[model samples]
Target chain A: MVRIQDLPRKNFLMPGNAACPGCPETMGLRYVGMALGENAVLVIPASCSSVIQGIYPRSGIGMPILNIVFAAAAAAASGLKAALEIRGLKDAQVVAWAGDGGTGDIGFQALSGAAERNEDIIYICVDNEAYMNTGIQRSSLTPYGAWTTTTWTGKKEHKKDVPLTLIAHRVPYVATASVGFPTDFIDKLRKASKIRGFKYIHLHAPCPVGWRFDPAKTAEVAKLAVQTGLWILYEYENGKFRISPLSRPYRDKSKRKPLVEYIRLQGRFRHLKKSDIAVLEKYVDEMWEFYTKLEEIYK
Target chain B: MEEDHLVLPLSRPAPGAMGKTGTWRNYKPVIDQGKCIKCLLCWLYCPEATIIRHEDNSVSVDYEYCKGCGICANECPVKAIEMVPEVQGGA
Candidate 1:
């Protein structure tokens, strides 16, 4: 339970940037900056961050950022880490920050290779659930029954479990965090910094414009996702898996809020009918069941 | 050989890189000092990093850079902040 006053005062994600009002990317990046401080270099791919970083001639973010291509963020970070080591700058952390489209789809190969080789770089996948940078196109991580520009009738496939995929790589650390819980995210970033090898933090950032929700409800919507048991916050470190303290109470089915409370808030889930809600709820239950089994095995 | 040298356009790090995004907002958040608890939750969640958390634990909104997202007002547990229209002359 880190206090607000206890957090670092340095603002790495400076104001007057290109980020939209109530953008979750900015919120998450704020925590990342507070945790890592001045000793970090971000590897950003072709995503909203590339634009939010502001156009050439002036940059918004305080940290050094290496803007790479769509599918080369993780690979670039790995090489950057090697370069830093050779230059006697081992303390400088190289972070690969990418969107779901770049991480789950295009950059998955590079990310997996780095994870397999156990590269010492922090790879953060800011999952906004779709290709939000280039309008709302459905991506591999987009949940089922969610409306997107490409999926007008709602996506037919379920959201890809990227964290679990990373965990299978037996990485040193893998955590799921949300923009709603800034303290939890900040704590996780600090923890990841201490560990060596591939550290993957899947940050759930709800996009207001793409999700068709009120800009102010960004935090509210993210909170509902976790409260409804739709998005589980947990960490996998060195083969030991456990739910985060914030989400521990939600393990009990009775304690969890109804899935509709989370879904109805977003216009993207408006197309979901009663039957669709039921399916989504069942999917949530299955996900919980998987987590419970995982805890039993590893905890 | 001198003509073959590659010269690239570069952007320097600076605050207000987008140039006073405060102009983009239609509504701005106004904090009621009496109701404020000095919780600094608004400061924690501000996307623009425009909310200044002073040394005394008091929080103030820097309207010059704040895009007026209403997130500060929305997330305020004490309901100390309110969103007001920027242009008072408009209906």
Candidate 2:
């Protein structure tokens, strides 16, 4: 197993890509590519990456990309890997890179099926929390009390607990990472790349445009997301679950920054009332408490 | 490479050049190394990959293609970067 620090220094995402400024998906994709090495095929669905990868007859992704439908990334990747194995190539890797809308909503069926079947694929769900590609429509992953074009007053429903849902299948791997934590993010991707059966990494990417935040604060926002316990960073491997070392400090509860500190930085929650924020805060605390219990049990 | 491919913009990494998006900027980000804690967040989040990381791990921006999006400045955890108005000179 290649050490996380020893991952190759090569740049596979290239420089001229069309991603928006301070795009977290671009950051996640770059690190994932670096850790995954170059001998991999990326199966992307219809999301922001589709546009960022460039217009037809011109592409920016250094490696090959198979752009599947809105809900077929994992299934296509499964088929691709089966075909590769049939051709006597088992060492190659197949990656399904999809946005939260694709993974948690539209493509959840295929992804669930792929994971249940133990397909040898790396499925990365870059969660920016909304359908950013389709003009910032709210998706199941959009956090509660966040304003999208469709949810002008903020979403009334809670964000889907996608990682736990994935873990339910007892897949060989399930992890939560954030663009703000590159080392942990890449480490999980590298570790997932080496494992067999199904692997999934729910990377919390920040969408500046959709979230109505300065394009430059994507990393900062993502960082605060984890520090405030609003986003949990943990991994599930071989029936064991543990919080990531990067987020271990927040286990003290006192070390966690306030949830308000994280939400106020972005404009999406501008319309949210204090009561709504309290609800969100309670939800965050509940999730963190759940993680703490898991950490204790795993330890 | 058939036209019926499922991937969007059915194309592999195309050759040739991309547009010179540098000219689109009205301001540019300037990194102050003294204030820099070497967090590397700016480098990691740079959409254009213009944040060049030296072998020594110090980072510098590639102004040749930067669009003055100020992303690096916004993401720098140490607040070591500043966005400055660009004075264009066509001469």
Candidate 3:
């Protein structure tokens, strides 16, 4: 069942290694890596992830991580899977753990190639919404009206729907997860790990640095990301789609918290006016409608 | 020899023997034992995994590699951890 309480005790990711304190990416990696267990190998691309794992030998992530270029994590993971299979290590999971820049922007081509081929690799994008490692630059995954080094005035475009794009690739397993909900995140990772063919797990990892929130509120931010419909938790497997437990109540617009409740929590969105909040609210409503229609059509 | 070193699968002479990283930290998290509820929040949120969760759920920082990012102090729900600026030469 992958209980949240059992996660910290598993110890896949060791302490006294490098990673910013209150970094949600590492927290996600710890939970996912523990759920995947000792048999898995991580393929990290150039991002905060590479930094989070530390500088090589002292890497905090307990699993063996194959660090690759910015846009080639999925490709390297595919190659690693082939090598391991040739060596007869078939059941082992080859995880492509990447940041938003790696998965949504620069690495999208290779990621699409892997998903199209249905490569037998478990791909997880731990999105913190910006290029946090190289300074908080705007990536395609950064949400609308959020500040970044490149988008000093706030990103004019909407956040890229990376997982939905993956689902369109018709991969066997596709899902969204949040680190705030450890049980849900663990359950999704465990489910994806057991399934074959290019499984996509999109984790909405919170970044205290880029998100401009108090480090202590990392969990609260992650939870509210779902409660406010800023990030939805759901899974699509074998053509069946289901909303996660914590996000189910939020399926209805009236039930969800106001978008301001989410925006006010982070400093990145502080520049936004009430009209901007209204824009995001409309965007959320459109997203909910889009998801509902997509589910119905697929169902 | 250069190529051999370059081709190494995972290049660390020793895992986590990454030298005294403690010297880099500008601040250190001091646990207020009296106020500590032993909740383990600091241990779980620590990126370095530098904090050790004891059998009794009480936690201790491993000074060997604790880079003092203040995640422990920041995450402690009971406000048990206080981040003190690191002073040179133990002063």
What are the interface RMSDs of all the models?
A: 1.2, 3.1, 3.6
**Model 1 lDDT at residue A35:** 93
| TM-score of the second chain for every model | 0.83, 0.74, 0.77
Ranking by TM-score: 1, 2, 3
lDDT for model 1:
0.92
1 or 3, greater by DockQ:
1
Better of 1 and 2 by DockQ: 1
Q: Write the per-residue lDDT of candidate 1 for residues A1-299, one digit (tens) a residue.
A: 78877999988887899999999998988888999998989999999999998877788888899899999999999999999999999899899999999999999999999999999999999999999979899999999999999999999989999999999999999999999999999899989999999999999999999898989989999999999899999999988999998898999999999988888889999989898899899999999999989988877
**Candidate 3 lDDT tens digits, A90-202:** 88899999999999999999999999999999999999999998899999999999999999888999999999999889999999998777678788888888888999999
**Candidate 2 lDDT:** 0.83
**Which lDDT tens digits does candidate 3 get at residues B40-82?**
7676666666777777788888877777667677667899988
Task: Give the 10-residue window scoring lowest on summed lDDT in candidate 2 chain A.
Answer: A1-10
Clashes by residue pair, model 1: A57-B11
Model 2: residues with Cα > 4 Å off, grouped in runs: A1-7, A296-299, B1-10, B14-18, B32-41, B55-58, B75-80, B87-91
Clash count of each predicted structure: 1, 2, 5
TM-score of each: 0.97, 0.90, 0.87
**Model 1 misplaced stretches (Cα beyond 4 Å):** B1-8, B89-91
Of the candidates numbered 2 and 3, which has the greater lDDT value? 2
- lDDT tens digits, residues B1-91, model 1? 8855966665667778888999989899998989999888999999989999888888888888889889999999999999999989752
Q: Compute the lDDT of residue A183 as modeled in candidate 3.
A: 72
